[model samples]
Target chain A: MAQRIDVKDLDIYYGDFLAVEGVTMTIEPRSVTAFIGPSGCGKSTFLRTLNRMHEVIPGTRVEGSVEMEGVDLYGPGVDPVAVRRQIGMVFQRPNPFPTMSIEENVLAGVKLVNKRISKSDAADLVESSLRGSNLWEEVKDRLDKPGAGLSGGQQQRLCIARAIAIKPQVLLMDEPCSALDPISTLAIEDLIAELKQDYTIVIVTHNMQQAARVSDRTAFFNIAGTGKPGKLIEMDDTSTMFSSPTEKATEDYISGRFG
Target chain B: MSTTAPPTGKARSRSASGRAGDRGMNRIFRLVSTWSGALILATLAAVAIFLVLEAWPAISLGGEELGEQISWFPEDTSIITFVGPLIFGTLLAAFLALILATPLAVGVALFISHYAPRRLAQALGYLVDLLAAIPSVVYGLWGILAFAPIVYPVWNGIAETLGWFPLFEGPAADPPRVMATVAVVLAVMILPIITAVCREVFLQTPKLHEEAALALGATRWELVKTAVLPFARSGIISGAMLGLGRALGETMAVLMILSPGFLYSFAIFQAGQQQTIAANIAAQQPEAPPLGVSALIATGLALFVITMAVNMAARAVVARRKDFSGAN
Candidate 1:
C-alpha cells in the first residue's frame, strides 16, 4: 500500500555544518516523484533523511520532521530500524549479498529480520517478487546460484526485488540506473513506471531527461556556491516544470545553460 | 609540425641499453625480485631436508639405542611412545586456545571495526595491536606467577564438583601448572593476532552492502550477521589458523605453565601429566645424548607438518564456497 509523505522545514546537518536547509514538500501516494539536481546539491542527502538512513553516518543530524501516514518517523521512542521496515531503498549501485543465492537474495528482507516462513510460502514469495521485478524467467532455473553471478542489470533488479519483498509502503531510489548501460537503464525506467502503480516512489537522478520522462512531480534542488547549503529551488508538475513556469535557476538547469 | 628528437632519442637509448651487454636496470630489477622469491622456497626446502636428515637416526633405531628415561626426555621409551603423547598435548593445548580465543577475538574485532565510537576506535585498535608486541616470556611469567594462582581455586572447585568429565578429572594441581593453564596463556598470546586480522577484514566490508542490510530494517547486530560476518568468514578462518599456528609453536609459555611429563592424560587440570612438542624440545634438548637429540628433532618435524596441514586445511575451507566468495 502506498503512503503519502509530508516533510516539513527539514534541515539536514553533518555535525555543525548544514548540508540542506529549509526544505518543505508533500509527496503524493501512488505516484513517481523525482529529485533532479547537480553534484553536492543535497537531493540525495534529503532522500536519505526520509528513511533516517543518513543517521547511519556519524555526526549527521536532522531537524524538523518527516511524517508518513500521520506518524512522525523521527518521533521520540521511534526506532530507526522500525521506520526503515516501512520504507525501503535502492542505491546507485546494485548490492545483492554476495553470499546469498538468487532465491535467498529475493527473500533477504524477510529472512534478515528474523521472521520465519514455511517452505511453500518462501517459494511463493520468491517467485512473486522475482516476477514483480521481471527477473523470474531469467533466474527461475538458477535460483540456487549466487546472486553475484548475475549481470549488472539483473543484479540491480534483484536488489529491487529484495527491497519490495518486505512490502514497504514507500521506495526511495538514488540514481538506480546511473551505473547501468543504456538498454538496462530503459528496463529499469519501465519498471519504475510500473512500480508507481502500487508504491509511492521517490528517486534522485542527475539526468534531466530521466526526470522529465518518468516522474509525475519534479523537484529541483540548487546551491548558491561551493560551500553553501542546498535549497529546493522549485517543485511543480513535470510538464510545467519542463515547459513553462519555474524559477530562473531551474530554467537554466533544465536548458543545460549551467548547473 | 616540428620534430622533437629528444623524446625519441631517449626511448631509443633505453631500448639500446636493454640490448647492450649491460642488460639495463629493468633486467636487474626483475632478476633481484625473482631471486628474492626463489630464496624463500630454497630456505624452506633446506630446512625440511635438514629436519628429515637429522630425524633419520631416531626413526631407524626405534628402541634399539634406548637409554634410561630422563624426566623430560623419556629417552628410555621408543620414539613412537615418546612423541605420541607430545602430539596429543600440542593439539589439545593449541585447539583449546583456539576455542577459547576465537569468539572473544572476533567480538573485540567487531567492536573496534563497527561498534566503537569513531574517535575511541582508533585508540582501542592500537591498544589491542600493542598486546601482540609483548614478549612470549613475559606472558609465561604472568601465567605462572600471577594468573595461575588466581585461577587455582576455580580449577580445584571444578575438579571437586565436575570431576566426572575427563577434561577436569582428578585432584587439581595445587600450583595450577597444567595444560589448561598453558591453554589460557596461549589464548591470551594469540588474541591480538586474530583480532587484528579480523578487524582489518571487517573494516574492509563494502559500505554499499552494509547500507543495503540497514535499509532492509536490519538492526545493527542483524546487519553484522548478514553483511559483515559472511564477508569476513574466510578472513576469520585465516586469522584463527594463524593464531593456532602461534599457539602450537609457542614454547616458553607452555614450558613455564605446564609441568613437563610424557603421559597421555586427558585430565588437563592435573599437573605433571601432559607436555607439548615445542616445550618438550626446549626442556629436554639441552640434556639429551645424540639419539635423544634426534628424537627431539623428529618431534620438531612433526610440529612442522602439523602446522602445514593446518594451513592447508584453512585454505580448503576458504576455497570451498568459491561461488559465494566476496572476492567476486
Candidate 2:
C-alpha cells in the first residue's frame, strides 16, 4: 500500500506576505483528493508545500510539518531531491523536455538519475509507464518523436507518464486540466481516476464540476479579505461536500452564491 | 411608427478629412521603414563590390608559382609572399582564440544567468559591456606593456613542465611576442561579445521548462544540464561564431602581441614566425608595392569569405535548433 501525506499547521509565505495559513489536512493513501478554490486562494501553494515544490521559488518559505509514511520530509537531514523522487508533481502547463524524444522523456527520471537500466528494461519501463497513463495507444508508434510535437492533451499525459516512470508514491497536480480542451480534460480525468487506484493523488482545480466528478474527497479553500491568508474552509467526502457542506462558505462557494 | 433621421453633412466631411490625414501619416511611416531596409542592403552590397574590385588585380596575377619562389617580389612585379603567411596567421590565431574563449565564455554566461545573485549578475554584465567598449588600440597598448609580461612567466612554466610536447618546446624570449600571445589577446577582446550573447540565450530558457525539471527532483546543476544547457547549445555556438568573426578581423591586438613574420609555423610560442591577414594589411598598406597592396586586399577578401561562411554555418545550426536560446 502507498503511504499517506500528513500536513500539520502548514503556513506558506512568499517573501514577507503570508499566502496560506493554518492549513491542516491528512491526504489518505490510494485516494483522489481535490483542492478547489478561487484564484489566489493558495490551493496550488498548499499543494506545492506537500512535496516541498514551493521551496523551488525564490523567497518562498513553509512553516509546518509535512510527513510521508511517518518520516518528516522537511527535517534538517532530509534532501529535497530525494523527497521529490518519492512524491512527484505535474505543473499547470504540460512541459515535457522539448529536446528529448517521447521515449526519452518517459524514461528521463530513471535514466538521468540512475543510469543503470538495461536497454530492454528501459524499453519495457517506457511502454508500461505510457500504458499506465493511458497514453501508450496514442503515442506508442511515435516513441521516437519529440515530446514537444505532441498535442496539448497528449503532452500532459506524457508528463504524467514521465512522473509515473519513477514510480512515485504520491502525485501532486496543479490545475492539470486548465490548459487543455474539453476532450483532453476528459482523457486526463479518466487517467486520474485510474491513477488513484495505485497512488495517492492531490489536485488543485478551479473547476468545481471536475472536483465533484472525479475526487473521492474535496477540500474547499478561500481567502477571507484583502491581504489575508487563504484558509481551508471545509473538507469531506465529495458527495457530502456538494450535497450538504458543513460550512456556509463551502455551500456558498459550490452553489456560485459567493466566493 | 414614425421616425426622423438626423443629417451629418458637416461631421461626415470632417471625419473623411481626418481619415485621409491618418492614411498620409501611415504612408510616411511605411516609406521610412522600407527605405531604411533598402539602404542597409545597399550598403552591404556596396561594401562587397568594393572589396572585390580592390582584390581583382591580385586575383588576375596568380600566386601558385610565386608561393614556391620564396622571393619577396613577384618575377613580373607580383607580390604574394606577404599574403600567404598573413592569411595563415589570421585563421590560426582566430582558431586558437575560439578554443580558449569558448569554455570560459560559457562559464561566465552560465554563472551570470543561473548562479549569480540578481544584482551581482547585472553588475558583472555591465562590467563585460565595459570591456567590450574599451578601444582596440587601448587593448593593443595594454597587451604590449602589461599582458605580455604578466602572461610570459606562465607560458615559460608550461614550456618547462611540458617541454616534451611539440607545442610547448619553443625557445623562451623577451616580451613573449608569439602567435599564442596574440591568440590570448584576441580571446580577451572577444570574450565580452560571446558572454553577452550566451547570457541572453541562457536567460530565455523557458521558466516552465526549468521548473518542470526542478519539480521532478532535479538539483540546480541537474536542471541546468537537462533544461538550460540543451536549450542554449545552439545559441552558444552562434555566439562563439560572432566572437570568432571579431577575432579574425582584430588587427591592433594581434599586431602588438605577435612578432609579425611572413613564415607559417605550427609552434604558437615561436616569436618572429606568425602573421595574420588584418595585421599584414595594416603593416604594409601605407608604403606597399602595387602588387603587394592588391595581394593584401585579396587576403582581406579571403578573410571576409571565411567570416561569411562561419556566419552562414552558425545561422544553419541556429535554424535547425530553433528552440535553444544562447542568452547567458
Best by TM-score: 1
Best lDDT among the predictions, by candidate number: 1
List iRMS (one decimal) for every candidate.
6.6, 9.1
**Candidate 1 clashing pairs, residues 3+ apart or interchain:** none
What ranges in model 1 sit over 4 Å off?
B1-29, B68-76
Q: Which sections of candidate 2 miss by over 4 Å? A: B1-29, B62-82, B160-166, B322-328
What DockQ does predicted model 2 obtain?
0.34
Q: Model 1, B257-284: lDDT tens per residue?
A: 8987777888999988889999988987
In angstroms, how far off is B30's CA in candidate 1? 3.4
**Residue A5 in model 2: lDDT:** 89
